[model samples]
Target: MTNEELKKAALDYHEFPRPGKLGIEITKGFSTPEELSLAYTPGVAEPVLAIQANPEDAYRYTAKGNLVAVISNGTAVLGLGDCGALAGKPVMEGKAVLFKKFADIDVFDIEVDAKEPKDFIDTVARIAPTFGGINLEDIAAPSCFEIEDALIERLDIPVFHDDQHGTAIVLCAGLINALELVGKKIEDVRIVCLGAGAAGIASMRLAVDLGARRENMLLVDRKGVIHRDRDDFSKLNKEKLEFASAASAERRSLAGALAGADVFIGVSGPGLMKPEWLMLMAENPLIFALSNPVPEILPEAAWSVRKDLIMATGRSDYPNQVNNVLCFPFIFRGALDVRARTINSAMKVAAVKAIAELAKQPVPQEVLAAYRKNSLSFGPDYIIPKPIDPRLRDIVAPAVARAAVDSGAARLPYPAHYPV
Candidate 1:
């Protein structure tokens, strides 16, 4: 859609529906004044007292158990960098609506006017007690890494920057299925990430953590491939170097990194990779050009040389869209259910494996007609499961929660319905 048409639709779409997608609703029957009084004023005070006495009871007394804060400073909204706080509200609101609709999780999107890292961190930390978790969205990289680290360190609740880990987890899951289709092993694969931003770094880390050998991965930034040669680096860049450090120093440029690489992950920017780059890759290449609005390399452009390529993009119009929406909701649901203190690497790996396994399951009859496959078996085009797929929340959540429990991040004991 054109920019003007998109804006007009966004502005006019929420007309006469109580301003937007969400509205407060009474969960219990309290029609009479007496019932209302008991539910609201005097009787509600009792529950408040009880919660105050035992702070853990607040989950029982309030919506804190299932609500998340979609907090942002609007500095890094989806592909539109540095749009400021007010401008980011619509996207944040849309995210909250998605959280609610997809996982039955309530979301309050707070766009802080403050741009400074310290200010943003301070504001969200103070207000974090109100929700089960914090979903930090659309903040720029480097800063996003710091914010998430600080928040996770400071708060007991699960704090996730969806741009980083969410996208990474889903991307890894897609890679798992993609690699399987091509008869490749994770440890043996040479992967080159085009962007050294949040998603790129996180994807590399998750891939490494999930058994992709450190020497097999190479990350590229604006200054070309991130390597020991580059002196100017952020703290996050240092962390990335720990992974790429052991790789042969021979790999410097994007072309050097792409030589015989099995997977190409593009979180960088548009047109960073040419079709020639795809042709240079190992046979049965897996390419995820995940830049929004436009990918690093267009699918048709890449596919011209290698029809055998397993390709994906950030755009939903494509067959395998590597969007974070598939990961965050299910991850949060599992974390919340288990009262996970943090969503750690173990939990993320479990999520990736679960999602990969789910995609391989037999496609239900209802879905079979749409794809026209005899069995909803996984392959190149069906690597990661779609966000709208009903089985996702049910499948991924329990696995994450289980991992949380196993990893000692869970505040609660194992549930009776643990597998569920």
Candidate 2:
């Protein structure tokens, strides 16, 4: 569709149905006065008292177990940066729709107009009790780090900043399969991650957890490659500093950094990854140019340079799309089901493995029908599972839940409702 036509359609979609994308739907009936009394006044008091006596009873009596809060400050709204919190409501509501549709989790899209990290942290901690999990969205970088860290420390619920770990998990999932296809080990491969924002830093860190060596990673931002000799460690955020590479003088620039690199991950903007740089990458290299609408380098351009490349993007049109939707909904599903306190590295790794492994299995007929494809095989192009696959809920969720339980992050046992 043309840009204008697409804009009109999107606006119409949000307007014609109602004022917004979300609405409150009562799960229980209360049509009669008797039902109303049972739903609210007298009967509600019993559950309230029970929950007051035993805090754990809130999970049994209320929707807290199934509810997640999609909170945002809109400071770092993707595709449109620094839009205010009020402007970010639509995006937050869209997230809620994904949560409910994908994993049967309810959500309240919260747009907080806090000016600083302290205010946002205070607000979220105060409202923490209302949710089983908190999905932080679209907040700007260093402050996002601060807010998420403080809230996770304060709240006993599963708190995740989707822009960071969600992208990281799915990226790792695809990366795992991509490396397997190329017959290379993650630990031995060199990876150059462009854009040292939340997604870049998080993906690189998670890659390290999955066996990628810290010394093998070259993180680049707008200025240049984040080398150890840059003398800017004090200026870098704690998250970004973890990735500073103590590389030789030749690796100080983006071009030099991509020299024989096995993986080139671009969370930066469009066209920043020159086609020439692709030639410098190792044989059978992987490229994740994940900027939305336009990637770091277009696939057509990259393909012209090298046919031995496995490329991924954030667009739906691409074969291996690194999407956050594939991670957050089901991760929360598993975390909530098992009453996990935090979404730790083990659970994230389980999600990565589950997503990667799912792509290897023969495509189910239902999934094939959804994609309008006869088959999807485990290969360079089809590395990550499609976000629409119903199996992700059953497969990824149980994997994460199992990991949570095994790693002592879960308060409850492995849920019987989930598949064995």
lDDT of candidate 1 over 1-420, digit per residue (tens): 999999898788875556766666767888899988889998899989998899999899889999899999999988889999988988898898888887899988899988788999999999998999999999987788888899999999999999999999999999989998999999999989888888988999999897898777887877667666566645445556665553455677788788899999999888989888777789999999998889999988988889889999988777787878788898999999989999999999999999889888876776656555466457777787766777888888889999999999999976777564
The global Cα lDDT (0 to 1) of model 1 is 0.86
The segments of candidate 1 whose C-alpha lies over 4 angstroms from its true place after superposition are 1-7, 231-237, 243-250, 368-376, 418-420
lDDT tens digits by residue: candidate 2, 98-146: 9999999999999999859999999999999999999999999888888
**What's the residue-level lDDT of 42 in candidate 2?**
83
Q: Which 10 residues in a row give candidate 1 its minimum summed lDDT?
A: 239-248
**Whole-model lDDT values for every prediction:** 0.86, 0.92
Measured with C-alpha atoms, the lDDT of residue 85 in candidate 1 is 95
